[model samples]
Target: MTESHPHPLFAHGTLLDPQVQAALFGRTVPTTPASLTGHTAGPLEIADGSRNLRREFGGTVEGAVLHLTERELAAADAHAGDDFARRRVLLGSGEPAWAHLDARPLRPAARIVIVGDSIAYGRCDPQGGWAAHLAAAHIASNETGHRVFNLAIPGSTLADVAAQTPPLLAPRHPDTLVVAAGINDSAELLAAPDTTRDNLSHLADRLTPLAATALRHNARMVVVGPAWLDETRLDDYEGLRFTTARALALRAALRAWCEDNHIDFIDLWEPLRDRPHLFVDGVHPTPDGHKELFRHLST
Candidate 1:
C-alpha cells in the first residue's frame, strides 16, 4: 500500500507578507483561509554588498506552508506571473518527509540550503516559494536528512557576503551556496561610480577566496545570475541608455566571472527576457519569476 502524501509547502521572504498573499492568491474566503502559526517572524538581513534603502529592509517576515487545491494554486500562479520564482511541496513542519518536490526525489532526511538576496527570499506572495520548489525537485527518497534553508536578504550585496562569509559559512555549513546579487550593486553603482566600481572589483576579487571558504567546508557553490533590467535608476541625470548598457555589461561580466570561477551559474535573464510582468516594481522578482528560477535550477 502506498503512503498518503499531504500537500507540502515552505514559505519564506515576502510571501510571508499578508498583503502579498492578497495580491497573489486574492482574498481568501473565511472558510478557506489557511491558518498559519508556530513560526517567528523578523527582519531578514544580507551580509554583503550595498543595499537599496526604500526597496530594502524593515518588514515583518515569516515562514509557512500552505495546503491548497490545484485550482487555487493555478490562480495563485497566474497572479504570480511567469517571471516569478517557482514553488514546491515540502513538509510544513520543516521536517523532512517522503515526497517528490520539484520532480526531484527528496529522501525523508536530506539537508539542503539556498542563499541569495530578496528575490531568493520570495519578496511578495504567500506560501513559501521557489526555494521550496527547488528543494522538492532535488530531494530524493534515498537522500534522507534533506533540508532547505533560504538565507536571502532584501538589500544584501556581494560586499555583505564578502565580509560575512566566515560566519555565514561557519554555523550550518550548508551543502550548497547560491549567491544571487547585482540589484543592490546596480543602485549602489549609480550612487558612487568610482567607489562602486572599486567595491565591486573587490567583490569579484574575493569570489575566489569566498569559494575557497565554501570549498574548505565541502560545500558546492552555485552563483545565480542577476536578471536583466529594462529599467535603470542612475545618478547625475544619466540617460537610460547609458545605465542600461552599463548594467547589461555588468551582467555579462559577472556571468563571465562566475564561469571562470567554476561556480554553477543559473542564467535567469535568458528564460525571463520576454516576461516583464514577473517583476514586482521594475525590480524584485515576482513569485512567478522566483518559481521560474526554481524550475530552471531543477532542470
Candidate 2:
C-alpha cells in the first residue's frame, strides 16, 4: 500500500528523468500522466550551464504523479540539494504531493564522476579502466544516463587528490564519488606494517570533501582500494611497498575506515584474488581485469 508516505509527489524536472529517478529512489517511481497548471515551465540553468526545469506563472506543465513516503520525499530533497526546493502541491489525483522546484541545475542523468589514480584513467589497460567500462555498460543499458569523466592523475597520492580535486568538483555536486587511491600512498608513503595503517588514517580528513558532497546530496562515497599486484614486479615498482603484503595491509586499513565511517568500500583483492593473469604489469588491470572489476561494480 506504500503507506509509509501518505502524500504523493508531482515531478516535472529531473525527477521525471529516468536516470535521476533511479538514482534518488534506488529505482524509478511508478508515475502516471498528470500535471500542474497556473505555472509556466521554465528552463533552469545548472552551474554547468545545463538546464533543469522551473515553474513560472503562465501555463501548464505536464509531469507525473509519484506516491511516496516521507522518507522518500526527504531523500529527494537531499538529492536535489539547495538548488532545488519542494513545495506542497495538489496532484491530478487530488492527493497532496511535493513539487520539487529548481533553484539550480544538476548533473544530467548518466554522468558518473570518477576520482582515482591511473587505474581510473586507464593506465596499462588501453581499453580504459573499470570506470570507463562502467560508463559504457550503463550507456547501452536502459540506464542510458551513464557518462563518465575520469579525474585521475597518473601519479597522484591520497593527499594530492584530497587537496586538489574537491574544489573543482564542488560546483558539479556529484552523487557518487569512486575513489581508487592507496597504491601511490602505499608505495611511496609506507615503510612498515604499522606505518601502512598510520599513513591510511592520516589521509582520512583529506577525503572529507567527497564525503561532505555525498552527504549533502544524500549520495554515496565508494572507495576502491588497491588491487592485488604481481609480486614478481617488485623491482619494477621502484622498490616501493607495492609488495603483496603491504598492499593487503593497506586494503584492510582502508576497508576498516570506510566501515567505521559508514561508506561503501570495494575490495579488488577478492574479485581478482585468484586471477593474477588479469594484471598487465603486475599493478594495473588489463581489459579482462577491467571487465571483472565491472562485474563487481554492477553487482
Q: Highest TM-score: give the candidate number.
A: 2
Model 1 TM-score relative to the real fold: 0.54
Computed on alpha carbons, the lDDT of every model, listed in order, comes to 0.49, 0.64
Please give, for residues 202-251, the per-residue lDDT of candidate 2 as tens digits.
Answer: 75775666566544432345678887788776654654646777678778
Residue 297, model 1: lDDT of 63
Instruction: Identify the runs in model 2 with alpha carbons over 4 angstroms from their true place.
Output: 1-110, 142-144, 170-173, 188-198
| TM, every model | 0.54, 0.58
lDDT of 1 by residue, 1-299 (tens): 11133333344444445566566557531121121221123232211111111100112213345444555454544544432323221122334211111111112113445556666667774645667666665554324544466777666767776566657665764645667665565554445446524344555765676676655544455667767554642233332122455556557767787656545556767656657687665555577876876667666
Q: CA lDDT of 235 in candidate 1?
A: 35
RMSD of each: 18.6, 11.7
Backbone clashes in candidate 1 total 48
Model 2 TM-score on a 0 to 1 scale: 0.58
